[model samples]
Target: MLHVLFFCLCLRQVNGEFVDDEVKSVMEGDSVTLNSGLTEVIDEDLALWRFGAENTLIAVINVIVGSVTVYDDVLDERFRDRLKLDHQTGSLTITNISTLHTGEYQLQTNSVRKSFSVSVYASLSTPKISRDCSSTSSSSSSCSLLCSAVNVGHVTLSWYKGNSLLSSISVSDLSISLSLPLEVEYQDKNTYSCVINNPIRNRTTHLNNTQLCPPCPECGHCCDVTEAVIRLVISALVGVATVVVLAYDIRPRKDE
Candidate 1:
C-alpha cells in the first residue's frame, strides 16, 4: 500500500510539473507557434526545445521565479539558428521552415520529456508564360512563327499551327523562345498558335497573320520581298510579346 501511494505521488509530480503545447502542419519557409500554457515554471528547472534527426539541442530557456523560459530558433541552414521558444506564452516559433526540418520534436523540462511532431509542406504556384508570339509570311521562301516565354528556363516547348502539332523544342535559357520552320506557304490568311505546358502550368497563344501575301503570279521566281521579310520579323516579335503579357496580366485577377 505504501509503494502504490508513492508511485501515485511520483506520477502526479511528473504530469503536473510540466505540460506540452504542440504545433502542427507548418509550411516550408514559414513559422510555427507552440504554446505551453499554465505549465509550472520553476527557477530550479530549465525549459528546452530540441529538434532534428540526430536530436541536436536547439535552444534552452531558463525558468526563473516560477516564470516560463522563452526561446527562438529559425528553421534555416539545416535547422541551425532556426528554433525558438517564448516562455511568456510558451510558444515555440520556428522560422524559414524547410522539409529537412520536419520531424518529431522532444521538449524537455527539468528532465521530463514530452514528444510532439511537425510536418512541413511546400507551397508552390503554377508557372506562367510571360512572353508573346508572332507569325508572318515571307515572299522569299517560307512562313515562320516566333514563340517565347519570359523568365522560363530549361523546359519543353511545343508549337501548333491550327490544331496541327508542329514541333517540340527543349529550351535551356532563362527566357524561352523558339522559331518554327514553316513548310507551307499560303497566299491568303493563316491561323497559327503555340502551347506551352509544364508540370506547374499550361499556356496557349493564338497568332494571326499581319498581312495577306498572294502566291507569285505566272511562274515568277519569287517576290524580292525584302520589305516583306522585315515586316514578317517585326510581326512575329510583336505577337510573342503580346501573348506573354496577356497571359501574365489576366492570370492574377482570376485567382482572387
Candidate 2:
C-alpha cells in the first residue's frame, strides 16, 4: 500500500517538482478543497500552506499531533472563520471565497512542496446596453453603443459580431465595473452581442439599434417635429417668392 501511494505521488511530479492541476475555477461565495494526499504523517512532520508570490503564510498543521495553527500576523481578518485544515489528509478548505482570494497557492511538507492555482469569480452580472449618441439631449444618426457590467470580478468583457470577435477587455479586480463601446453604424442589422464571462459561466446582451438608439430627426423636438419642419419650409418658400415678385415688379421703379 505504501509503495502504491508512493508511486502515485511520484507520477504526479515532473523532474523533482510536484505539478498541480493547471487551474481550478470556483464561483465567489463558494467553497473548494485543495487536497494534500500525503499519508503516514508523523510527529515532527510539518505541513505549511501559503498564498501569493511572496508566500504569505496562511496555515500550518502538525500531523501526528493533529493540531492546526493559522498565522494571524500574515492572514488577518480576510481568512478568518473561512479557512480549514484537515490533519488526517493535510487538505485545506476555503469557504465563501471572494475574488480577492484568487491566486496561486503553495503547500509544503518535509518531503515535497506542491503548487496549485485558484481563480474565484463573482456571480455573473447582466450586461447593460445603452445609447451613446453624439448628442445626449437629442437623437443623432451617428450613435455608438456602450455595454457595461457593474462591480464584477475576475472576468472578461467582450464584443462580438456573429462569430467574429471584435474587441474584449479583461478585469482582474474584484470590485469594479467596466464598459466596452461598439462603433455601430446607423440602422446596423448585423447580430452583435456584448458578453461578460468568467471561465465557468457568462452573461450576454444583444445589440439593438432601434430599441436603444433611434435615428435623429431633422428637428430636435420629439413631438410634432415632422410637421414643424414642413411648416418652416413652407414659410421660407413663401417669403422668398414674395421678395422675388417685388424685385420683378419694381425694376428701377423697382428694387431698391
Cα lDDT listed for each candidate = 0.54, 0.75
In candidate 2, stretches whose alpha carbon ends up further than 4 angstroms from where it belongs are 1-22, 39-44, 71-73, 135-142, 152-154, 170-177, 183-190, 208-256
- lDDT by residue for model 1 (1-256), tens: 0000010111223545644434366545777654444354453267776666666566666665454433333443465566566655344666777667668676666545555566664433232222112444445455443455554544566666678888777655445344334334544356766666543345676654553233334224335466678889999999999999999999999997
TM-score for every candidate vs. truth?
0.37, 0.62
Best by lDDT: 2
Sequence-dependent TM-score of model 1: 0.37
- Which regions of candidate 1 fall more than 4 Å away from where they truly are? 1-23, 64-77, 127-256
